[model samples]
Target: MEDSDDFLRLILDSIAENIAVIDEGGGIRFVNHSWSQFGSDNACSITQDWSKMNYLSVCDSAALAGDEFGMLAGNGIKSVIDQKEAYFNLEYPCHSNNEQRWFIMRVSPFELNKERFFVISHQDVTERKLAEKAVEKLARRDGLTNIYNRRAFDEILSEQWQQCLTLKQPISLAVIDLDHFKLLNDTYGHQIGDDCLIAVSALLKNFARRTGDVCARYGGEEFAVIWSYTTLLEALVLSKALLEEIRQLKIPNERSPIAPYMTASIGLVEMTPNRILETRDLIAQADDLLYQAKESGRNKVSSLIVVPSSAVENQN
Candidate 1:
C-alpha cells in the first residue's frame, strides 16, 4: 500500500497542470509538484506549504477583499462542493504587473476512501485568450481610421445609455463634421481626404482619453464622442479646449472656407437620462446642434441640454 501511494503521487506530479485535492471540509489535503511551482512562478503568495491552507477560505477572503475573479471562483467551487453541480470551470485573467497571463480553473468532485473530495486543476490559457481578444478588437475597430466602427459605436453607445440611465449619471454626446468635407475631397482626391480623416481621428482619440470616454468614426467624414458621468457645463469647457487644440494642428484644407487649414463644426448634447427619455433623444438633439453649428458658421459649436421637464427652464 505504501509503494502504491508513492506511485500514485508520482503519476499525479507527472501531469503538467497544477493539481490539488481538497477534503470535504474544504482544507487542502494534497498538491502535485507543479502546484507550488506554478504559484511561485506566477507570484502567488500562497505557494509555501499549500497543504496547510484552507483553500475555500482563501478564495472567500479574497472575494471579500474586492477581487472579482476570486468571487467567481469561490462561488463556482462552493456550488460543486455542495453537490449542487457536478463540475465547474472558469477561465480568468491572472496577469501580473509585468506580463499578461490567463488560466482556466477546473473543479470536480470524486469519492476517495468513502469520503467526497474535490480535484482542482489550473491550466494556462494565455495564448487562446490573447487570440480571442485580438479577433474581438479587429471586429470592433474601423478599417480606415483604426477607431471603432459604426456597428461597435452603436452598440457601445446603447449600452452606455442604459447604464447611465440606471445609475442616474450624467452623460455627454458630441457629433463633429469636417467643414466643407465634400469640397476638400473633390479638390485633393480620396487619398488626401482619407489622410485628413486619419489625422482628425488621431486628435479625437487624444481628446477622449478620460475614463469612460469613447471616440468613434460614426461614418464618412463624420465622428462622434461620448463622456460618461459628465454634465453639459463640464463638456462645454472640454470642447472649447479641444477645438482650440485641433485648430492648432494646421492640417491644410485648401477648399475649406472655415479656415485655410482643416476645421470642424461640433454639435453637443448633455443629459441625465430618466424613465421618460430614450437614447435616440440624445442623438437627435446632438445632430440638431451639429446642423445649427454648421448653419450659423462652418467652424462653431452648438449645444443643447436635456433635463427633467421641471428643470428644463433652469437648464436653458
Candidate 2:
C-alpha cells in the first residue's frame, strides 16, 4: 500500500496542473511538486499553509467566478467551502525579470475526507493580453501627434467632467493657435508647416505632465489641452510659459508675411467646482480668449473665467 501511494503521488506530481489536497475546511493538506513549483507564492508555500499564502488575499474570486473565463474553471473555492460545486478562471498578473505577465487559472471542487476540496490550475497568458492592449492603443492614438485623437479627446473629456464633479476637483481647458500660420504655410510650404505643428505638439505634451492632462490637435493650426485637478493660476502659468517657448521657436519664417520667426498664441480657462459648465461652453470660452489674444496682438496668451450661470469674467 505504501509503494502504491508513492507511485500515485509521483504520477500526480508529473502532471502540469497544481494538485493540492485540502480538507473540507479549506486547509492545504497536501501539495504536488508541480503545484509547488509554478504557484505565485515565490516558493514560499513549500511548507506554508494555504490560508497563510499572500496571493489569495488579493484574488478576486467573485469577479472571476461570474465571468465567462471563470465558468470554464468550475466553481470557485468559495462554493467549495459552502459544500456547493463551483468553477472559475483566475487571472493572475505577475511581474518578473523586468516583464509583466498574466496567468490563466482553472479552479474546481473535488471530494476529500468525505467532504469537499478544490483543485487549481494555471497557465501563463501574458502575451495574449499584451497583444490585445497594443491593438487597442494603436486604435485610440493619433498617427500624427501621437496624442489622443479628437474622438478620444471628446470621450475622455466627458468622462473627466463626471470625475471632477464627483471628486469636487477643478478642471481647465485651453485653445492654442499658431500666429500667422497661413503665411508660414505659403512661404515655407506645407512640409515645414507640418513640422512646425509636430514641434508645437511636442511642446504642449511636455507642459501637460500630469496623469489626467490631455493634449490634442483640435484642427489645422489649432490645438486643445484638458487639465484636470488644476487651478486657474496653474493653468495660466502653464499657458504663459508655453506661449513664451513658441515665441522663441526661431523657425526661420523668412518666407512668411508675418514675423520672421514662428510663434503661437494660447487661451485657457479654469472650471471651478459646483459650477454647471458644459464642454462646449468651456471650449467656446477658450476660443473667445484665443481671439482676444490674437486681436490684442499676436504671439501672446490670454485667459478668461466663466461662471456656470453667469457671463464671462476676466482673471488677473
The C-alpha lDDT values of all candidates are 0.85, 0.73
Report the C-alpha lDDT of model 2 over 1-316, residue by residue, as the tens digit.
6569899888888886666655545456577776677655564433545554423322345346554433433336556556554565667665676688777776567774686666666666788999988988877777777777777778888888778878988788888898888888888789998888888888888877898898887888888889998877788888888887886777767754457888777788878646556777777878888888888776777876656666454532
Tens-digit lDDT track of model 1 for 121-175: 9998998988999999999999989999888888888888888988989999988
Candidate 1: minimum summed lDDT over ten consecutive residues — where?
307-316
Which portions of model 2 miss their true places by more than 4 Å? 1-25, 39-76, 79-86, 90-92, 96-99, 109-117, 155-163, 180-182, 254-258, 273-275, 278-280, 291-298
Q: Using TM-score, give the best candidate's number.
A: 1
- CA displacement after TM-score superposition, residue 279 of candidate 1 (Å): 2.6
lDDT, residue 43, model 1 = 81
Candidate 1 TM-score over all chains jointly = 0.84
As for candidate 1, its clashing pairs are: none
